[model samples]
Target: MSKIIKKIFISTIMVSTTFSLLMGAESIEISPSIDKKIFHEQYVSVTVKLNNKNISKVLIVTDKNEHYPIELTTQCDNVCSKIIKLRLGENSIRVEGYIGEELAYEVKNELYCASQAFREYKEAPIKYKERFFHTDKNEKLCAECHDMSNNEQKKVAFVDVKDSNCFVCHKAITLDRYAHAPSANWLCTSCHTGEIENKSKNIIEKSKFIAPKQIASACFSCHDKNKQSWDTKKHKHFPVEAGMCTRCHNPHSSDNKMFLRVNSSFLCLECHADKKLSQQIRGNSKCPGEQKDGCTECHNPHASDYRFLLKSPHVDKKIDNNIKGK
Candidate 1:
């Protein structure tokens, strides 16, 4: 009789343990599963579904350092379901369910914030439109893939393509370098189109692409008529022969007017190398033997309305003619 009592007691203990494990498993269901790569600053919503109608009260606990807990209650007939919003960095949620005054089940599972889920979602889309702008063979080909049926979306894509395609070809040059290049920034695209089979096979074809004369033509694309008129003048700077605008002028701003690379006399002395010219000008005295005399007293670096880049009173034609007559 004592042996029968002992066996019955052991069986009862086993049954209680099995019941407790099953109830613990059924207390919560979290979706999307858990993993690493969860960040601390994202918002998340967690839902808990209760198993037995007898379970009336639920208590939740989390690590206070990472997340704040928010209590949620939903009514259904006589029973209430509870949800707790928890923000935990490296802690688990503990859920304790109670029936009236008795504890029904105690369960725990790891918690993850929404930031991890968002990162995974972002990675899943391989071709996100926000990051890459697409182009085609004619380079007008974005309309083929973009949604043409939707007018608003089509306009947005067209604007993005127009603005971003320049960067695609000119990526090799930094903005500062482009700004200071002999031909200004906007004209870089007219010549260096990146297409294969041109005389310059591509933008990378150094020997053909960096030809000084072709770079000059890039400026003439907009200024051809102006250059043609200037060429008619008898005296011209040698940069006209070498096709080098940067020889006389910095394409960007300068402390001196007319965008000349230096003050007038210093600029002329670059080629003249005359010690008298430097000494005469360095003393802040006027140029010798002429009124309003300076480098501009004689020559024009660029084509001039007057004979020598000169202002009104100095625009004389007979000075050189009379000197030759002597």
Candidate 2:
């Protein structure tokens, strides 16, 4: 009985020691995983997993032996990712891990940059199928459009509006779509001026594209006539009165009519959340006589002369105090 107990304790000690040795082995893993060879975008986010936690530095070595040091915020426990810019053709990258001056571990990855041809290949991963807005053609010209300087007083979204370079690559925004008037004219600064009113709630600190807190303020600048007309109406939609126009509308270009985020009925029901209306629209209700045309069949989205923002008079029904009325 004493000999059996001693043998059990010895086996447990040997197993624990072997497990610790395997866990401490140094290695590096690179991804876009070697099997998926092609990447649609020039800039690819590569994740490196380090089994040895002591590695203090990470670097990418190109096939030509050019070493680019990657800045790590901290010595990562196991994983760190960086956006690496790849050359236009077949390329090889070696992700190397180091402790101070000495190399610790390294892993190699191969990738092909074929932005245009990637869309036609159906087998490509969904992430790599669509070409990113900032592709190879526009990669180098970022400073041309963006405000690169850190001047506190003169910081704007773009460097200059006189020769707007946005439309050069973004011409597809207006192709066969109902473009917002300002977007059609390439006057992006009308909304995104990188300056907002001091008191506005949507002031994002260090924002890449500075837009107005009150989106309606930008819309009313051009649509002053509509604002003046809507202001006097007896009934107004909550979002419209509160100047939250983007709740249902897309500020940028949209394929939908009137630049709606989705079809008017679906957009209206999203906020209204009436079980009866939702069931009727979805065709799941047992009640047969349902109006499929949706909320606009009775209620106007923005403002109406009648009660409940109705397109026609609804004097037969009782008024609800919860709804806003002039």
Q: Flag regions of model 1 displaced more than 4 Å.
A: 1-187, 191-214, 251-259, 275-284, 288-298, 304-326
RMSD of 2: 15.2
lDDT of 2 by residue, 49-148 (tens): 6666677888888897877776765544466666666766667888878777766667666666653212233144433322222333323334433443
TM-score of 2: 0.46
Candidate 1 structure quality by residue, lDDT tens digits, 32-105: 22223232222233334555666666665664633333233443322222233444334466656666766667
Best lDDT goes to which candidate? Answer: 2
lDDT of each: 0.45, 0.60
Candidate 2 residue runs with Cα over 4 Å from true position: 1-141, 144-163, 168-176, 197-204, 275-293, 314-326
Candidate maximizing TM-score: 2
